[model samples]
Target: MAVDDFKAYIRKIIHVDMDAFYASVEQLDDPNLRYLPIAVGGSSKRGVVAAASYEARKYGVKSAMSGRLAAKLCPDLVFVKPRFERYQEISKRIRDIFFEYTALVEPLSLDEAYLDVTVNRKKAPSATLLAKEIRQKIREKTGLNASAGISINKFLAKIASDINKPNGQKTIAPDEVLGFLETLDVRKFYGVGKVTKDKMYQLGIFTGADLKSKSLDELQQHFGKSGAFYYQVVRGIHLSEVKTERQRKSVGAERTFNDNISSEIYMISRLEAIAEELEKRLKKHGLAGKTITLKIKYSDFSVQTRSKTLGLFIASKELILEESKALLYQERLKNSVRLLGISLHKLNSEQNSSELSAKEAAAASRKHEQLRLPF
Candidate 1:
């Protein structure tokens, strides 16, 4: 769409982001872990960091960095395995708090969400006040800190949320949008990644002010389709609304290697791990998918995906492994692989719910038996 065609909007949106969620949870569970450098996951050379504590981050440790490097960066970094079930429970508790204020909630991930509170359940006077209340409630109930950003739209709101670190809130008012954006570095704009930032610097577009000088056509000529996006957003013209219903078309999990591997044996082991994680997610969400896809990213960063659709929905780890293995061998490798992934598509929620019901029934029966036994 042309930049001129963008809609004009000034809706109140709030972005809530948890502070190092997985790492914070670990600290909350054990007080001794607080104030210490901690990383959740990536204990092995091949393992990757899932989350890092603030103390660990100070030493340049981060999620997606190799466990070995994280350990090297912070010699005292304590590594702990992730407990997805516990995280899910905490996520639910936080979401329940969101629903108390507004139904126009869109969860970006387990740790962050965008809320449209222009008109809300409690009739709050300002989005900033609501952000404070929501953050306070989250801390009180979950024993964790959340940072919030409030602004006229999702773009500004998301950027505002990050202005204050752990347990803080920032608001960008409607009238102040342009000025606020002008001072912001071009690199700080939501969608500008490392490569784009470098290109922007090379083109003398170092700040939002510099970027605003370029016409939509010039931006398009230099950056292709994303040019129009950068042109409008810098001028405070993002028109995306807060969508309450964001559906999951597919579920996937992948691992990025610190080094590429050509060994089929190592590849299968990685695929097995990916399939297991995908299976856990499928069961967690009560979803069964008929199509299974295998994604591969080579050392050069070139990516490829292969998928197969079955006649019926299935949510089994063994089956995921079997199908993904077939896809792995279906095509010859262009280069050594650096990442492997497995995804489930064409989901059937009703079938998945039945399977969850059976599992719940069996667990209840075991509990009943235990209660009946004399101690």
Candidate 2:
């Protein structure tokens, strides 16, 4: 298809996210784990749960909760260590299914992805039907349940996906959006986190309806930048696009050590892995960054970060690691480090028009400077 025709066809978007991915994977691998309360992660004193099954969630178990607390909540809750390799394998399988319909796929994480299926191979007219079939395929192939959301844009599609639980699909047609959003909870709105929610509650904004009742000035007074987002979301005017190829502003990777360590060598080993991951992502995206940041989390949960800006943008993985390792040792850390992360910030975009213009101006200026011939 021609580029303009493809652009015209790219309108319908569907977001698909598996319900309790890690826990579901565990259940798929072992039938005994099915229908039983299970939390995937560690059950040790200091460990944390990565995913909690719906059955386990009934007892208040949740992801990121301390393993100690999860066990206390559900005494029989099974904790399984995460197998990222296996998860990635399944993720690839899931993505392959998306390719059967459209090539415009944006994966949010291993378990969730957005697909632009306005023009699909199957010639499916309704996005809802496509969502349902894709979900069914995922379940039949992997013995896992996936929830799908169909909408006119990425924002609505993301919201719709979570409306229904496992093995379900929800569609929000463009015309029904206003009423649909009015009754939605404030927490469900994208970008409204714990802090924003609390502030909105103070202003008597509990639901989308309440938020819509307020004027733009009223919202902006409480939430300077985020108030605009609230105003737009309440009006069902989400401008966020379904970007298949987006220039990442940052690339980062972080990992928690097996045991807390004060030794610099152990910390470096962890940093190496993080740097490697960041490098791989940078190479995959065909991008680079001018800033390198190093983050450290102590045993007591206290966190610290250091960053340095380079003169030139660099895409070399070796250079990223070299600069990151230097930043790690540049300062003397007093406490034992439990987690380490390496990130590349201030990423240079490969397709931004403004960046291209700036490059052109700089080249022209350099040419003028050379003509001056300063001795």
RMSD of each: 11.0, 11.4
The residue-level lDDT of candidate 2 at 27 comes to 88
How high is each candidate's TM-score?
0.83, 0.78
Model 2 CA deviation exceeding 4 Å by range: 1-11, 43-45, 248-251, 257-290, 311-322, 346-375
Compared with the true structure, what per-residue lDDT tens digits does model 1 show for residues 84-124? 88998999899989878876777888999998776667866
The best candidate in terms of lDDT: 1
Residue-level lDDT of model 2, residues 214-270, one tens digit each, is 888988888888788888767766656544555566888888766888988777767
Candidate-wise lDDT, in order: 0.84, 0.78
Provide the lDDT at 288 for model 2: 89
Which candidate wins on TM-score? Answer: 1
